[model samples]
Target: MRRLSGVTIDCAEPAVLAGFWSALLDRPVSAEHARPDWATVGSRFDPAPRLTFQRVPEPKRGKVRLHLDVEVDDIDEARARIEELGGRWTGERHDYPGEGVVLGMTDPEGHEFCVVQYF
Candidate 1:
């Protein structure tokens, strides 16, 4: 069986983007894996797959089709914290009576992600 390795994100600034993810995930950026054009957060020894960032010449142009969903204990708190980290709420929210709540947000660079809270 093949195991999923890690997810790599393309961004204009690898280290900066990695910093955002590192803080959000509470994972340290791997100094050993950092370079001028690349940066990584989390370690191979960790059970979760590491996140890597690669430098790209072009800026993000349209809406991202694939986005990350960050599960949190409190959606409002998480949204506020994300905004403190240079992210912003996108005014998109959904709620299910007994299921959960999902709020769309964007990173400093405008990458979209969701903050989810389940009841």
Candidate 2:
């Protein structure tokens, strides 16, 4: 069986990025890492997926090949909260009516992620 372990994001400041993601996910930062160059955040439950932030010297230049898909109870409310947390809403797709909605957003560092809602 295959299971997701964690996802790493490149940033100039690992602690700062990790704080943002930790707040968004409502989880605590990892205790394993005690360095400013690298930080991880996730829950203590089963199948916990860590969001690792690593320090990089240069800024992101191209499009990201991978992005996160977060499940939210309400799409509109989640989008608003994300925006307040330094996330920018890119767009939304409404293909399946009353089923689900996908809102594209970017992090403070311009990493694209999606917020999905299912009814």
Candidate 3:
């Protein structure tokens, strides 16, 4: 059986970004890890997946080949929260009409991702 383990993001400061995501998801940082170069946040109660932040030397450029889609109850509220967490709202794409709404955004390190709301 195939199972998803974790998603890792490359950033200059692993702990900082990890903390931001931890607050966004309301998950506690993993106690098993003791490395400054990497940080993870998640737990068995939620049981979704761990978000791992890794240290990288260079900054990201152009478009990201892979990104995440976060589901939210309110798109506007989610966008506001992302901004308050040091993320920037790039733009919104409404191609699917009534199917869903997607807002393109980048983290502090410029890694592009999308916030999607489906009804």
Candidate 3 off by > 4 Å: 43-46
Summarize candidate 1's per-residue lDDT along 1-119 as a digit string, tens digits.
55766888889888888888889989999975757999998876778888888888998999978988999999999999999988999999999899999999998889999999999
TM-score of each: 0.94, 0.88, 0.88
TM-score computed on alpha carbons, candidate 1:
0.94
Candidate 1 residue 31 Cα shift, in angstroms, is 2.5
Report the C-alpha displacement of residue 71, candidate 3, in angstroms.
Answer: 0.2
Cα-based lDDT at residue 72, candidate 2: 94
Candidate number achieving the greatest TM-score relative to the actual structure: 1
Over 4 Å off in model 1, which ranges?
none
RMSD to native, candidate 1: 1.2
What would you estimate as the lDDT of candidate 3? 0.80
Candidate 1 lDDT (Cα, 0 to 1): 0.88
lDDT, each prediction: 0.88, 0.83, 0.80
- By lDDT, the best candidate is 1
TM-score for candidate 2, residues paired by index = 0.88
